[model samples]
Target: MRSDLQIQQDVQDELQWDAILKAAEIGVSVKNGIVTLSGTVDSYSKKIAAEEAVKRVKDVRAVAVDLAVVFPGTIDHKSDSSLASVALDALKWTSFVPEERIHLQVDNGNITLEGELEWQYQRDAAFNAVKNLQGVRSVINKLRIKPGPSAHIIKDNIWKALTRDANIEAKNIIVETRDRTIVLKGKVRSWSERSDVERAVWSTPGVLAVQDELTVSL
Candidate 1:
């Protein structure tokens, strides 16, 4: 196991390596295996990028993102109405997002997406559409997946998918289904693999939510 100080240094280095983030704008601290990122970034996308960078470092157990988005003075801030219009346009252009079924609200540059879609990927696509908008400070995704038929088969399908995935050791994982939600319990070799397992679970047709209880065996 890596020490807290080593994890902190690697996280900082990882943030510095990411091209989208200004490394100096983010502060890194590690306690045990948990990393806390604080400071301010110019865009919401960069804030997401910083957290992702920390996740990529070896031995990082979990991440707490406390970064704030503060746009530079030179960039003109858009009024809430204008930001809403721009976000609508962006959603309309995203092919994966079903804009007709989704409703959004923009308040002081923070965007909230609320509606229901058939798949988790569509909900994710809708969030991605507005997160990079120039004036967006944060995005809250309240979008939900419409429940699919035959909940009985969800667990089996997810297990098959997990077994087929090259990155996951399916034998080490247990898949449990409660209605439309998947509860994953097991151990994964790394943070990335844990994410991979969750992503696979979400891609299944009947899955509406995932409760990931998988621990990384560092």
Candidate 2:
């Protein structure tokens, strides 16, 4: 296992290497295996980029983001009505999102979405549509999956999907589903592979949440 200092160094290096975020705007700290990111960014997208960069580093067990979004005064802040109008327009143009069913709520700079979609990807698509908008400070995605199939069927489908994935050692994985939540318990050779397993689970039609208890054995 890598020491906390090395892990902190790696995270700092990762922040610098990522082109989307200005490394100087964000701060990094590590304790045990957890990384905490602090500072302020002009946009919510940059905040997300910072967190993703931290996860890409090896030996990072978890991430805590203490970053705040403080846009510059030169950029005129949009009214809540303006934000909602723009968000609706963006969703209308996004092919994956069913804009007709989704509702957008904006307060100050925070965004809240509520509705039901057929797939997780569609919900994600809706979120991606507005997250990078000019005045968005934060996003609270409460979009849900419309009932399509049974939970037992979802569990079986997930098992098959896990087995079909070339990157995952399917035999070492155990999958359990309760309603829309999936509980994954297993071991994988690398962190990338473990993430792959969860990604596959998310791609499935009925998965609302994933409890990843996968250990990196390498």
Candidate 3:
């Protein structure tokens, strides 16, 4: 049986992936608590978005991103190198991120990315660019998102809602809301909590939709 921390991490990471997919952004697979990200993104930001989405999960040991680039023919040295270049280009071109902050390295078809950006959007841009490369097999993202007020507010509201409910344990779950879309993460001991939490979020005034990533551990 997984511990509470492990369960929390798994749920959060799954929620992150769901956000990306719902936005028509990218696709990810989580197996054995390891995340594999894949899909084609228009910009590098989308790639980073997918990876960060995975990293936010509490129990994720690591992520293997296989997202591809939109333009493949222009930079042709090797699969990994091409993907790296695309990622770099996306970061360099984006007005939101400074060139000095983002770094890229490639080995064969596997690309490694490192950087610090002002927002999750910039970080995701870098990840998306490399994940979708033509021959790229995997990507490892070591990037961080800069903090903001919105993130804090979302966290607070989600926490308050979860803890207030008798059926939900605050420690076992995580919550995130984007533009009124409430996403619930964590493992529940019973199905009642699952249904109850979904209803709780849906009842919240600002929530337009609720994405439940809850798992039942029987």
Considering every candidate listed, which one attains the maximal TM-score? 1
Shift of residue 133 alpha carbon in model 2, Å: 0.6
Question: What tens digits encode model 2's per-residue C-alpha lDDT throughout 1-218?
Answer: 99999999999998999888889888898998889999999999999989888878888877899999999989999999999999999999999999999988999989999998888889889999999999999999999877657889888888889888898899999898877788989787766788789888888877778889887663
Candidate 1 has its poorest 10 consecutive residues by lDDT at 147-156
* Global lDDT of each candidate: 0.90, 0.89, 0.61
Task: Output the better candidate (2/3) by TM-score.
Answer: 2
Model 2 poorest ten-residue lDDT run = 209-218
Q: lDDT tens digits, residues 18-70, model 3?
A: 64443344555556656676667544445666666665555555568787755
Provide TM-scores for the models.
0.97, 0.93, 0.39
| Tens-place lDDT digits, model 1, residues 1-218 | 98999999998888888988889878999998999999999999999999889889998888999999999999999999999999999999999988999899989999999998999889888888898999999999999888886777888888889999999999999888787888889899998999899899889997888899998889
For candidate 3, what is the TM-score?
Answer: 0.39
The candidate, 1 or 2, that scores higher on TM-score is 1
Give lDDT for model 2.
Answer: 0.89
CA shift at 182, candidate 1, in angstroms? 1.0
Error of 3 at 6 (Å): 28
How displaced is residue 61 in candidate 2, in Å?
Answer: 0.5
